[model samples]
Target: MAFELPPPLAELRTRVRAFVDDAVIPAEKAILEEDREKKRDTLNALRERTRAEGLFVPHLPKEHGGLGLGIMGMCALFREMGRSPVGAACFNCDAPDQGNMDLLLKAAAPAVRERWLAPLARGEITSGFAMTEPAPGAGADPSNLKTRATKVDGGWLIDGHKWYTTGGGDASFLIVMARTSDDPRTGATMFVVDRQADGVEHVRDVPVMSPPILQHREAELRFNSVRIGDDAVLGGVGEGFRLAQARLVPARLTHCMRWLGWADRALHMCREYVLTRESFGKTLAHHQMIQKKIADAVSGIHAGNLMTIHCASMLEQGLDKEARPYSSMAKNHVARLLCQILDDAIQMHGSLGYSEDMPFSLWYRFARSARIADGPDEVHDVVVARDFLRGALTTLV
Candidate 1:
C-alpha cells in the first residue's frame, strides 16, 4: 500500500533525473545528428560519465557492475532516464540489451554468462534478439516460426530469415529464436551466435519511421546453415517460448517505465508552455480545454505507472506465468497512454509541437512504434481478453 520509494532508491532517482536532464538531454543533438563521428564521440564520453557516477547498468546486479536494483527499482530509475530518448542507453540499460542481460542472468548458463553477459553488463558490447521474421514467418506472432535450427554434427545448423533484429547489424552477439521442433509453442529454442560467425549475414539496417538511432538500429539478418555447439543454447531446448516470456514480462514493463518518462517530460513541456503562452484572452493554462488536457495527462500517467509497478511487483514475487496477462494489460494501456500524452502535449503546443524546435515530433514516431514493438496493441488486447475469458477472478489491485 505504500507508494514511497525507499530512501536509497529515492536518492538514486534524484541522481538519475539530474544526470538525464543535465548531461543526457543536452547531448541529444550531437549524439543523434547526421555526423556519425560526432555521435560516436558523444556516446563514448557519455558512457564514461555514467560509469563514474556509479549509475551504469542500474537494473543489473551488483556483481555485474550494476546497482543491483530489481524490477521495481528499475521501473523508478528507468522512468527518470526515459525522459530523453537516449537516457537509458547512457547507462547501458536500454532495450534489447537490457532485456537480453536480464534473460542471460536468469536463463543463461554460467559459461555463457562469463563469455557474453559479463561484457554486455559492463557496456563493452551490444546484443540483439532475433525472433521476428519476414512475412509468412514469426513476427508479432512467435507461434509461426519459420527459422529452424536442426541437429547436426558437433552442433545445430541454424537456417532462417530474420528482420527487425534490433542491433544485430553490429552487435557483438545475438540471441536468436529458431524452430527446433514441430509444436508451435514448445518447438522453438534460443541460440547465441557471434556476429562474426560463419554464415551469419547482416544484410542492412531497415529504414523505419524514426531516424537513425545510434542505440537502436533494426537489422535484417540471414542464418544460412550457421553452426554452433550446444553451448550456445540458452535456458534449454524446447524452452524458447518460456524463456522469451520470462524476458518479455519484465521487458514490456521496463519499456513502459522508460517511455512513461518520455511522455511525462513532454507533458511537462506543455505545462511550461501553457503557463506563459496567451490564447484568445488569457494564458493557455487558464483555458478550460487546456486544463482538461493537463488533468487527463496527469491521471493517465499516474494510472499507467501504477499498473506498471503492480506488474513488476508480481514478477519480483516469482509470478512469471501469472504476470504475463498483467504485463500485456500494462503494455496495452501504457503504450496507448504514451501516444495520447505525447499527442496531447503536441496539441497544447500547437504548431510549435509539429515543428522540429521541440523533441515532440521525433518522440511521436518512437511512441507510435511501442504499439507494435513487443506485440501489437491487438495482440496484447487478445492476451488480456483470452486470460479473462477463461474465467479468472483476481484483479491487479
Candidate 2:
C-alpha cells in the first residue's frame, strides 16, 4: 500500500521535526546530569512549551486535550519526535505514560478518568505500568506473576515485589497487575495503586546503561499489604492479562515508530561524518565498506518504516485483534534493525560515535533495551512462527 499522510498530519509532522531539531536537541547537552529533579524540571518546561505550541499528547483523543490523531497520524508524527531522545517526553507521548493513558482512557471508571486520566492527558502527572516482576515472578511469562491482591473489608490488599517498573520513581500512580485467584488464565487483575499508598514502596532505581530519565529509569517496587479501594480496579476483575495485551500491542508499535525516527537520525549523522571525514586520502563515503554500511542502514530503516506504517494503518482500521501477528513481526524486525543501524552508525564515526559527544552512543544504549522491552524479540519471533505453523497467519501485505 502507498502510505501518505493527510495534509494536516503532514504539516504536524513537519512542525514536530522542527521542534525537535530546534528545541529538544539543543536541550540534551544542557541537561546531561543524572539528577532526577533537574531532568524532570527540564522536561516539564519543554512539555509546557510543547503544549503552548499545540503539539502535546498527539496520540490521545481530541476531547482529552490532545490532537486525537489516529494510529497512522501518530506513526507520522512520532517518527519526527523520535529524532531527539527527549522528543516524546516533551510532547507528553512518552511510554509507560502514553501506554498508561491509553489504558485508563479505555478501562478506567468515570471517576477514575476524572481524577487520573484528565491530569495525565494534560501532562500534569506521569504514570507507570507495573506488570513485569523480579525473578520467581512474572517476567516474559505473565502466568508466573507472584503478586497477589486479596479481597479485604473496603479494598484489595496487594502484596508483591516488582522490578523493571518503568518510570516508577516519578510516577504519580501505577497500574499494577496482580493475581486474585488460582486460575492462571482468569486469575489476574489490574489495580491503580497510588505511588504514596501505604506499603507501596519505591525501591532504588535499577542501574542500566541508558540515561536516567523518568521514562527510562527502571525501578524495583515492593507492594506489601498495599490497600486500594475496589474502585481502583482498572477494568473488570480477572481481566488483567487481556487488558495488558490490548495496551501493549499498540504501545509496541509506537515504540517502533519513535525508534525508526531515531535510527533515521543516526543514519543522517553517519552520512554527514562519512562525507567530511577522510580515510586513506579520500572521504570515507567513497569507500566500499562505508558505502555498504550506509546502504544497509538506509534499506533496513526503510523496510522497518514500511512495516510500522502497515501496522499503524491496520490499527487505524480497528484491526488490532487480527493485527497481533503483524504487530509482533514489525516490533521484532524494527527493534533489531534499530540496534544494527545505530551500531553501524557508530562504526562509521569511529571513536567519535562511541563517545558521549554524539547522540549515537546514547541512542545505542536506549535501542539496546528495545530488544527486551515490551516483549523480547525471542517471544515475538515465537508468536509469528507459531501462528504461521498453525496456518493462522494473516496477510500482512
Off by over 4 Å in 1: 34-38, 393-396
- Candidate 1, residue 182: how far the Cα is off, in Å: 0.3
What's the alpha carbon RMSD for model 1?
Answer: 1.4
**CA lDDT, every model vs. true structure:** 0.88, 0.87
Question: How far in Å is the alpha carbon of 397 misplaced in model 1?
Answer: 2.0
lDDT of 2 by residue, 1-397 (tens): 6677778888888899999998998887555553445446677788889999989998888898898888888889999998877789889899989999988898988887788998888888878889899888999888999999999998899999999999887889999999999797889999998899889998888999886754778989999999899899989899998998889999989999998898898888888889999899999999999999888888989988888888778788888877788889989988998999998888888898889877778778877999999889899999999988887776545
Clashing pairs in 1: none
Clash pairs, candidate 2, are none
TM-score of each: 0.97, 0.96
Judged by lDDT against the true structure, how good is candidate 2?
0.87
TM-score of 1: 0.97
RMSD in Å for all candidates: 1.4, 1.5
Weakest 10 consecutive residues of candidate 2 by summed lDDT: 30-39
lDDT of 1 by residue, 1-397 (tens): 5679999999999999999989999998888873344237787789899999999988888888999898889988999999988888888998899989988887887888899998898787889999999999998878889999999878899999999998888799999999999986789999988888999999998999987576577899999999999888998999999898888888899999998898899888998999999989899999999999999989989998998988889888888888899999889988998898888877888899988898888888867888999899999999888988886515636
